[model samples]
Target chain A: MIRGLRKWAVPFAALLVLAGCGYDDTTVPKPEAVVTTPAVPTTPVKCDNKLQSYAPSDNRGAAIANLANKGRLVVGVSGDTLRLGSRNPETGKIEGFDIAFAQRVADELGVPMVVRVISAADRIGLLEKGEIDMVARNMTVNCDRWSKVAFSAVYYNATQKVLVRADAEKDYKGPQSLSGKRVCAPTSSTSVDNIKAIQPDVVAVLALKHTGCLVKFQNGDVDAITGDDTVLAGLAAQDPYAVVPKQGKLTDEPYGIAVNKGDVALARFINSVLDEMRSDGSWKDTYDEWLKPYLLVDATPPTPVYGR
Target chain B: MSQTATPQAAPPPAAAATAPAPAPAVAAKPTPGLVDTPALLNRWQLIGMTTAILFGVFSALIQFGGWQADGRAADDTEQLVRVQEIQSSLLRADALATNAFLVGGLEEPEQRKEYDDALESVLRQIANAAEAQPADREVLATLNVDVTAYATAVAQARDNNRQGFPIGAEYLSGASTELRADALPILDALVKANTDRAENAMAGQHPFWLLVLGIVALVALVWLNRELAQHFKRRINKGLAIAAAIVLVVTVVTAFAALLRDNSNDSLREGELATAVSEANARTAANDAKANESLRLINRGSGEGFEDLWSVSAKEVEKFASRDTRSGWDAYVAQHNEIVELDRAGKWDEAVEIATKEAGGSTESLDAFDQLSQQIVTANGTQATDDLRSGRVVALVLSGLTLLLGVAAAVAVSRGIGERRREFA
Candidate 1:
């Protein structure tokens, strides 16, 4: 009987011993899988389209192609720039002259769009990275931008103008005549630098963004706000400020699309789209759709000069 | 104190012989010395039951082993799949918004196809993953809600833009925030569940061996009882006989441990995969939203506020996404320069041309993103399912098998006792 008991124990003991021995002492080996490469690395090209002399330099096309493949475009704009690109709080879309212009380019690509809301100071860096595809937020064309991004054909005419406190227009002349006066400008903008060039000794306080400048100027922050005439006019239209500039113009501010430094393909595509829009009534329609509602504060925008 | 000591006083002698101590002693229990009860099992009755006990231990050990081998892997993979599903949907939503924005703020026929492709793929993936794990209904439902909200945001943003309002940025921003808040929580939960499962599976690998040893010891007891009954032609070896029943119990315990280990491992794998997928998805969505913000701000008017969002978003994606868009960024800069040149030359029309080009490129980028996202999501999802299935199978099959084996062993031993008793009579 004892012997039988010993034999009966054999089966379970054997199985247990077997299972124990079979149990892997080592950790499970993971299979070596192929590693995937990260997304390709490339530098974004930025350019000032307004610098083009009819022919878009090579950079324009490159910028456009870059935008095309991403399946979406990033543009720097404002939602409160009323009549130019401001959004209606109720509806929630950017409606303005600048927005209209943005739509025209987007329309040509048959793709999606992303608009980064920005103030003036953000345009340069945003354009430099692939952050915003282009700065259509009423950016001014200037030499500094030339080093950053390629420009397209001029689209809108803007000129250096002065915006004074609602009651300061009586004594103000122009840039040179504003010596010893405290003026505010949006930081890192051609307007500030340009103002410095003209009124070298004027007191200049640079606001990081247009909104900041507007807020400060409204609160008696500075004696004047100087920038492109159209922008100054638009801002003045919103408040009781008076825009004071030379009867003609100080500096030309033609708004253009900003692309990367070597995107010529994008430049041509933009040019073609522009040509189509200009003749097809889309340009006029966009301008009217965005600008007409807010023109009551000022005379309706002068006809946009389309260079032949 | 005297009352509590009564129980201990009674067991003082026998307790030293029978191995199992009270549950309260668990914390203070010496580990290596007590992992198995072979020492106390040296008694005649215990020795007689050793075979059955060893079997119990073996079954337990194997059950735990399978949990580690198959359970954890499955859990991690499944979790990753869940994350992928959530992430993919976010990416899809972003693509839709960008497309809508580009299409003149309306459903452009040309852009619709691309939108449809991206949207359908992501939605389908979410649905499929949800189906795979019906246990995670909360997460799936939340994701669905987020997708719907995102779609609405895109539509509204478009409508507003067409109507000439700049609420596009607001709508897109809201959508992005909503995704982060609503959908991500579920993903986190799912990931945790899987992670726990995997850890449990890992733990089972070792314990199952000891449990099998217990089972084998029980089988040994049963064999000895039958042998003894036959040898003396008597009813039973009472001590050895009853101990055989204990072997069955020990086997049941081993089975439970194995089952639990497998379940835990499965959950763990699923949790890990879900996290990874969720991360990727969130990144994609945020990037899409940021891009939309960029467009809206630029279209509204150049300003620093938009730039801030853009930079933050770009920096965020720089770590997760490939840096392939630099050329694209470069191109946009070039176009911006062209526009500037035209503006400088007083050629607004030509400058407008440049804007069109940059917009086109961005649109294209959004379109292609959907394709890549879909591919990767599908791959990750497949891996997760495979692991989940493996753990589930082991948890279910081994649990049932070990339990049945324990019951059968008990019945066989009990019947042998009856036969032996009759033979003695």
Candidate 2:
């Protein structure tokens, strides 16, 4: 029996010795592709704009005309916004309220709409960098954006306002009540700058995305999300959150397509399209199609004021 | 056994041949007789010698058995210790996953902050421990991926909460749910794998004492038997008796070593394994319960979403029940069922209240889980500690003892063989 056991032991030992640790080599999934569309040229390409001379202070006006003739419309846009220049999870497409407007101008220009996605702070610099021809990313016309870039017709009228949790709606009225509370808005937009200018004591957190600003409100990270009514309305669609500073517009957030200072003709072309869009009901159609989903059905059309 | 051992029986033929002449050789020369007893003996002599040989064979067998047991026990203990630390972290992870689900679901200020703090801590602990551990790359990688998901969930949760969007809860709940579901099963698998090690540790303690005792017993018996022959004034056959005695003792110790090892394994299987599996199951259930509550909120009785979140969280709770469980989570299940029914009926307020009660009760906390989870955690912890108990001093001392005992057995066997060799010459 001992001899028999000894014979078996060696094989058992060998088998145990050969026993190896388990292993599995799983293939790692590659990172998802981000479709990087080419940036539009910001140099003044509006050859038609060269026919007319504009004031030297029109830094943005001169640049748009130089950039537009290159057959590319460098329209400054936002990439972080959903339903407007935001990523579409299904088709991997970027679409929204503002993009269509930019597309229409580019389409009318007979140029490729190379949308230069940007934060508001860089809108002016991008035009200066000759990296974009126009800014249509819901930019508010104030002394600030106007000082850097010449404006065109205001297509959309925006207002600075407050968004709060539905529960808090009963108490909060305006800037004074919002004191000691945090407010958020995308940096370089009129809402944040205006909040600073108006409710200077209000703590403001500047986020890159308006959605982010709105989320801060939801997380109770802030008391209010302060931005253009258009942006805030977009935020409200995703959540049941309410907008405050209840009635009437704050500082008039006049939506304009920013152009280089000297580019009168491209501005004229843009102006004519706005005119055509307004007269031909394209402007109303765009609003009815895009912004209508998030706004009141009785949303009144803002009168388009022409640039000098 | 026959299939493999048939060829091995070849050596016994030679032993039979050598067996005949030992008695004659013992008579011819006293000096040669000492070394040459068994080799010079025939079949009858060998057969007669076998009875006396039992002690020696048993002693050697006992010594070997003890040595094997000692080695296995040492390895088992070391592994269990390591497993325990990992298991504890995993346990905590399961709890935090539930917390994340709960907080993300509520998107309430207190809950969100709590979830964030707990999850961040879990991630940090996992990272810190991972650096110190010698875990498989795949396991480590998976853990890292889980951490990233956790981080993303936290970020997104924060974002959505700020916006007052319920989707933040949905995202966080999703992260916690998927992770808990996938993660616990893997951890349970890890715990199950070390069962053999736990048994080996328990069995290891006995072999050294058994070996030493066998050596002592065999020596005493051989000395007593040899002197008995010498007292009679005859060259008595005592070596075979000693050898035979050794064989029996060795066989007993070997069998005992194996038995004790099996006993330890049984202990681990019954104790730690059961605990790990049960606790993991409970944790997953808790997570599912929380997730279901969150989904109920996210769905908000909207469109097809009500059906979707319902299916997801329902499956999770059920999966926990199917796995091994320690405590009867019947209380939790009862609450969950009511919540689900209320949810199905679109009674949001009632479901929310029950959810709050179920989630908030300190007694039903995931840390304890009604004693079952605690017991399971303890069992797994105990099993896991075998390989992982820390302190270099204890390890050094244990290792030294094992080595000394092994060396002592080997030397004693070698000496016995040398003494028999002289008679064979």
By lDDT, the best candidate is: 1
Per-model chain A TM: 0.71, 0.73
- Model 2, B319-422: lDDT tens digits are 54323342345455555567667644535445546555444532244334424544555556555455223232433343334333333433333334334433
Please, what are the lDDT tens digits per residue for candidate 1 over residues A43-161?
54454443552352334335456773376666677655656666554433455788777777876666555565666666677666756666677776555566677666767766777
Give model 2's docking category. incorrect
All candidates: DockQ: 0.09, 0.02
Candidate 1 chain A has its poorest 10 consecutive residues by lDDT at A22-31
- Please count the clashing residue pairs in each candidate, in the order shown: 243, 105
Q: How well docked is model 1, in DockQ terms? A: 0.09
**Candidate 1 local lDDT, B1-425, one digit each (tens):** 11111211112333355666547665344355332222222232334333343354356446644644454455445544555555655555564555355334345565566556656766776677666555555556666777777777666555545655444444555555566556545555655554454444444444555455665666566567665655666566654555556555655655565556545544544553443454455345444543444343334434334445555655544444433433443444444445445433334334434433335543344334444544545555565556445545645466446535544454454344434334434
C-alpha lDDT of residue B21 in model 1: 59
